[model samples]
Target: MDTTVSVSAEPEKKPPTLFERLLINRNYAFMWVGMATSRLGNVVFDTALLLWVATTLARNAPWSAFAVGALIFIPQIVALLMGTFAGVLVDRWDKRRTLLWMDGARIFIVLALIPASGLFHLPFPSGSDIATFFQMGCAFFILILLGCCDPFVNPALLILLYDIVPEDDLPRAFGRGQVLNNLGTIVGPPLAAGIFFTLGIQWCIFFNAASFLVSFLNFMLIRPERNAQKEEVKAEQGAKEEKKAGFVHELVEGLRFVGGNGVLIAVGVSLSLIALGAGGLNTLNLFFATDNLHATPDIYVYLDVLYGIGAIIGALTVGPWVQKKLGVMSGFCIPGIVTGLLLFTYARLDNVYAGFIVLFFVGVSQATFYVSFGPLLLKVTPRKLIGRANAVIGQLSTFAGMISIGLASVLVTSPLHNKHLTLPGFTLGPIDTIFMVVGLLALTSGIQAMATFNDYKLVDKQEETPAEKSSENEDVSQPLISYVGRPGWLSTKKRQAAICLVGFLVCLLIILPVAFIAPSSTAATVTMSYGHPATGETIEGMECASTVATRQQLRTHLTLYVNGHMAALPTGIGIVSPKQPGVRALASNGNLYCLYPLHVFEADNIIHADLPDTRTYTLGQFFSVWGQPLSRTQIADYKADAGKQLKFVVFDGKGNEINYTGDPGALSLEEHKTIVVLYNSPDVHPTPFTDWNGL
Candidate 1:
């Protein structure tokens, strides 16, 4: 055959859709489907929880708005506490295992809401604020657990994406993943609202639980491709890096740097104001839907669907153009100002369908702002302090959100709940005033951001060593946008690779305990199965049995540390008045007020197990009797604040101690075995007390 050369333009290959890409790789397909399924469940669960508490449980209560607002803020508080440590945790653990466990935990958490919902339906405190408070506490319990699980899931997913997908296709993979996530949010609302209305909140919860189980199965099928030796080398490198800089130290440096710099501080403050207004809108939106908009709860949930749809449109449409044409500062700030104005308009709107259009734009503005925010931060922040700067801003914004929600809750619950203030064009009630005030704040932040960063430019100083670099790293002149679009996308975990340019921005933008009558530091109460003032009433299946046995019964040692200081184990715990510590004139229904199965004879830490049988009691039983609240995040008056954790250790008779990771309230009070409860002291490995010293 003679050689014949035929030159023709090569046909261009079309890019594969998300489904087509999935068909090529089994592992990545599993991961993609798993994430989508779980995300859908999560959105539905969140919707159900919010509506159930706000509408069904606390329907007409004074602080119904506050309780509704707390649903969002409380989780932010938890993130502030543990989010920093998540990166380190993810680096250390098996990514797949972590994913599976997180899904499993959330499934259990969603199911628990069923019993939690029944707390409101209880006849004893029906239709009362007390019952609502109790239900809120129960709901908080689940939220806290889910919140703790969330931080680990996100980072782990990012790493797993790197592992299972081809490096070149990572960006498209993540972008498509986001599309699915937004889709889930779009569907989740109406689905949750439908299930919530037709079948009840229980069905909504069960549906979420089933979705998680489905996600779990898909993840289980995923066999990640890993090079064993390479992983070992990677682990060693990670450990070495961990030793270089601690989060606290870096965060302090970042705070100092940010505090001194005008632009950085404005950036931090502006981000906070944005979070505040967004949260405020959400917190009051339910009430706005029913009261001003004159819509039902079913109609109210659809607003989220609209918001999600608008987000997709904004991200695809105005998001890139804003950065390209308006510059980073203007891009981030302009949306803030627009959103502020929209919030004011929303405050005055009466038609349900019209309000929907307004909410859709609000989502659009927020998404546009978020699109530029990550780049703006990268441009302004030094390469080294990137993580630290982000952390500080995240913390500040979270606090702002928490404060806005809290303040709104207080204002609405006061005499202003029903009071209305009419302006020239519109009327202002609690919801209206809140929307206006938050709107003004957002507007102020946007204006300040524009003023401060209007002429800001990126500087190239990556070559300078940390010791040589100045605090204000604005020496070399360059366009801010020029700094990010470069090839060095595979930077650190915070900066993320090109794969995460959009996903990172989308992800970055986005628990409380109980109170009791006891003299805890705080006033939040824990939820109980049943409320009883009688001596022998059982709580959590542990009977308030007699502790009056003359002979020495089982005595378990108890110790408590609140904020690193040892709090005195209060006197007369589980006792009806004072029996031996002081004189008691107790006669209840022809019988003396008996001691609970777990009771204290003195103000000491020894918890006497005076049960007639050998049945062991839980620390929770003693807490219920003592009128104190106990949970992983809370103990009596003490709470685990930001960057702190609640932890405990259980000791056996052999002087062996194991750190207990489960519920603090569920700790068993074995004879002579000391148990220590420590809040906000993760570093101080507390040991159980050995010397009972004769009770």
Candidate 2:
């Protein structure tokens, strides 16, 4: 009897009911809420930090702009390497306890800012002088320390999310998380600006620190039965027949799994490309706003607000609809297309308002992209492997970001587009070219996504098979493919070391030239000294004189010496001698004296060292035979110390001093007696001996 009993395959277990799928017992909801809160806080913190750097922090110290950017990126590199180990740790340890530890660590780290702020103004006493070096050093140290903590927190958080959420509802959970993230973006900047403007940067830092505390408290409230059960199973497993693997072993397994999974590898590459494009756009946006569109600070703020508003709108509207309508791949394509079109138009927009409108659309596109990509990643990845998968994705993204940051730096700063270039018929700048390239990449990505839309559906259908599906009732279970393979050359430890090396090398290469050149460009050291020429009294020290002069004093010529010739002084109360030749001596009561030769010479109220037949020398060198420092107070006391014994000698625009005897303050009474010397010299070297001569 060859009769085979025909049995209809039970309709593949219809996906679980919505509540069962998402809530997945109480643990899923707890994990979701915890992750959402943490993510929200992080987004807010990042926005505030970036804004602070771009405005107040940079304004307070202009040189810190690049440092701020470095701080922001350094953390990302750390997170990439730590993510793999963090995932393994989550599996090995009590998930709830891990969450608590991570949150607690973050809270403590952030709260350190309170004391750090005070350190930012610490006074370094040197005799009677106070230096700001200590304060600036403290701020820099705190920022670097803060950067270190970010890696552990980010990976631990992602692992916790996987522990709580069921596989089926992962997508929707990610979508909701994206919404909250966008909400944070909308709120964080304005709040930061308001707080900074009103209470200063310290307040903004404190507010962000407080937010972590709130999230930590919220996490403590959730009690999950699944985690308790897992604890019991782990306890029962005990020390007999040990199965805990090394972190490297687990990390290798993760890499192997990702490499084997076509879907994950594709997504990873796509994300990398996307990050590259986004980075380029970031580099160009400021230039476009400031130089191309001529946007004021207020206008830039408005444009940022518009972008946030658009993102919020997209999160509320398009994020959910696209996910439901077109499957994950197609959903991502919509935003990609929008982003491309917006960027294309962004480059061409000449009006500031038009640029703002384009930025709004760009924000909308980014929000939608996040919604699609986040959920898709969650859905496609196995629950147990979520940490590794995310880690891999993060690592790839960081790699792309590093490359993009480099490319952007070179392209934007290079001579090709350092300034606006006027071609035969048109003008273009680096920013314009950047926009065009970003648009093209985005458009290409959109097309690629559309072409691969069906792949998502195929994967989705395959996930519905009976053998593939895990028990719906099971909670907090590990994945079937838990053991990842180790590649020979690229172990997890080596990979991490490689990442650190790459980062270090890139930073070293980029910074070495600047460091080498900085000393020459910056004020090397300031020196001040005071001494009494006649009284032998020592005065307070003043700062070392800079070669550059300030716009405080006006100069007028009392005489000019061109090849040893002199003339009568010009009529002006604001007359002063040049640093080089035609130098004038001012008495405490405002009398001017200058040396004059017996011939007509060219003279003017200007200061120029390169003037023909003019000799230049420092003011101190002209007054005293030796170069000696003088404090403002010492200058003020010069007449009192000299008394009637002071004999004044003045030089023309040149440093040669001539003898004069009179009451120091009585120059106004003897105006006719003052002789201004003019010497024959080329007009190219006109010297200003009087302040009013130029006018």
Candidate 3:
């Protein structure tokens, strides 16, 4: 007889909800709090910056808005170019330390913007040409330095998030982070606007600096050692490759892994294309609100608040709901199409409130997409190759953004600014056209995603258990597998290297135009005024000085040429022509002078070549460079046939004057001298500009 007892099977435990997990997880809680606080500061800083540029500085000069955008995006352009290499470094460094130091560095860098404000002439002098340009340039440099910190900071954060969060709880971890980020978005703008209106942009910047410190301290408190076992596993795996792969080879290995994965490539590529459309929105949304919707600053703030609210709700509800209903792939595809429609509708709405409503839903769609996409990214990418996979996606998206911003710059600044396009049956403005194009692209991406869904249906198939997948290299001959486990371009390390080299060149091509073609301002300046010395109606304001400085510092003389006559005093085209183009170039648009601060071109008021030590310029070369006409019979529009003779004169700072009695072109530009040309108005003897020392 057998005395056998039947044992009951233990019930399976259900996973905790996102909120429940956050409540119990200490490290995740710290990261969430730190990110939320810092994000609040970022939103406030961005709002303050936009208000300062739009309402305060570029309100009247809308084109100057492009300059403001260039300042912000130029750094992003640089960061994208270097992001891949930076990711390689992150894979080898202590992620926690890297994040902490970067935040610390940001605090000091942000504080510097205050002092820079003094140099850039903040509170924006109404008529100072050099002040606004110089300020924009200063803002650019500050943001550029800030941007350098991101490539390191972001990748480290990505790595750390994976390091600390349990795989099953990751969806909740990311969702909670998104909710907090959106919370910052909701509260930050209004707070920034309040601070900007009450204290100033400086205080808003100060708030951001302080927030960085908060994040830094929180980062210090986080105990990443809870994930020590996982880290050990990674270390052991890394040790295996130590004997075979060098840095480049290791990077190539990651590339080969990603290249062999079809789902990652498809997601990365589609997102990149969609990002191009999103660029126009980022670059032009503020302008659209202010210019097209006729919205006030308060309305703009309100619209953003609405968007934030919707985003928070969506992050909490929509993401999970979509995944449950449509599965991962289908959920991702549906949102893109809906988001496109919402965005397109937003562009066409004339009523601000209607726009506010539409943009809220747009935010919902975006948050949902992000939530779903984040998990998909983590699911498919291998632990060892996660950094490079993310780097590849980031680089592609950034490259798209760079292209879009460049295109936006061209469209916004050219005839497209306010010009309307007459299509076959309807008329659309340039901005509207941009919206339509972006909308169609997003919609097309969604349709393509639907068609591609079947290709990845088996991605979630459990043919292999998690352990089996983890032991993916058991087949050493094909350590990394393609969709069909077939060898392709990434079959060899050499092929992977070739792909990486080509990718690097592509990045270079994308960044070149942003660096070279975008309008970059300088801090060096020159005070300028134009008009008759009698009434003395001068163009008040310092001009943006040229970025190019003199090879060897030297002062120069000026001698104006006209018709064929000489006068007794100096005045005309350039009142403050420095010996160097460094400061001068700042004030020139091509060869034409800008009514600085104003950005208006004064074609007649231009400086030609640098002052010569001994060689003289024919008054004709001046006209050629100035895009004007100078001849024996006519000086400018003034004609010699009308009983009028051109007069040219030279003067020293001390009022000592010499009447030139030769061809106007023959006069010498001696050092420390002033030249003037009186065209047909010989009776009007202009006073020499004696403020050379002040310049």
Local distance difference test, each candidate: 0.67, 0.49, 0.60
> Across residues 1-695, which tens digit of lDDT does each residue of candidate 1 receive?
13332222223555676666654477888888888888888888888888787656654445667778788887888877778698789988999999999888888888887876662345322323344567778888888988898899989999888887877778668777767877997998899877775566778878888988998999899988788865886788788676665756756777787775556766786787777666777787787776566566677888888888888888878888888997777888798788878877877776878888998998788789887878778876666677777878887888877877876676666534445443467544556666666666677667666655543455554655766554444442222222233334342222322222442233222101111111222111222222223355665565543324322246676766665665666444554432332222121224444555565543346676655565667888777776677898887666677777777788864357876799978888775577887677555555544223211
Model number with the top TM-score = 3
Query: When superposed on Cα atoms, how far off is each prediction in RMSD?
Result: 20.3, 16.4, 14.8
Best by lDDT: 1
Cα displacement (Å) at residue 404, model 1:
1.4
Instruction: Put down candidate 3 lDDT per residue, 1-695, tens digits, no spaces.
Output: 13332222223455767666554477777777778778898888877877776544443343654754675577788787767778879989999999898889999988888864542434432223455566656677777888788889877988788887777878667656667777887899889978876677789889999999999988898888555679788888788866665778767876776666666666675587578777777777666665445455555687888888888877778878999887777777777888878877876765678888988898888778777786776667656666678867877888887787777666665645434433466445555556665666566556555544544443442555777656736432232323433355444334433443453454344334334443321111222223221111232222333221112112223333333233211122332232232232222223332221112121112122232122443444433333345555555445676576656676753346877776655554333345666656555555443212111
Off by over 4 Å in 1: 1-24, 118-134, 227-236, 239-248, 260-262, 459-695
Candidate 2 per-residue lDDT, tens place, 1-695, comes to 23432233345456667776655556556655666556655654554455444432332122332434454555656555565566556567765566677677777776665553442533322101112233334455555555555555555556556656655666666656655666666665566556554465567666666666666776777664456766675576585226647668768878887776545655675577577667766644544664456553324445667787888887778777877887666777778777877887888776788887888888877778876776776666665567788878877877887666656556554432223434466445555755666676676556555544433343343545564455444222232222233455664334433543553454344334333422221121221222222111111221111111221211223333333333222211111222232222221122222221110112232222111122333323221311233222132223213222222334432223445354332222111122222223223222212111111
What does candidate 3 score in Cα RMSD to the true structure? 14.8
- The local distance difference test score of model 3 is 0.60
Ranking by lDDT: 1, 3, 2
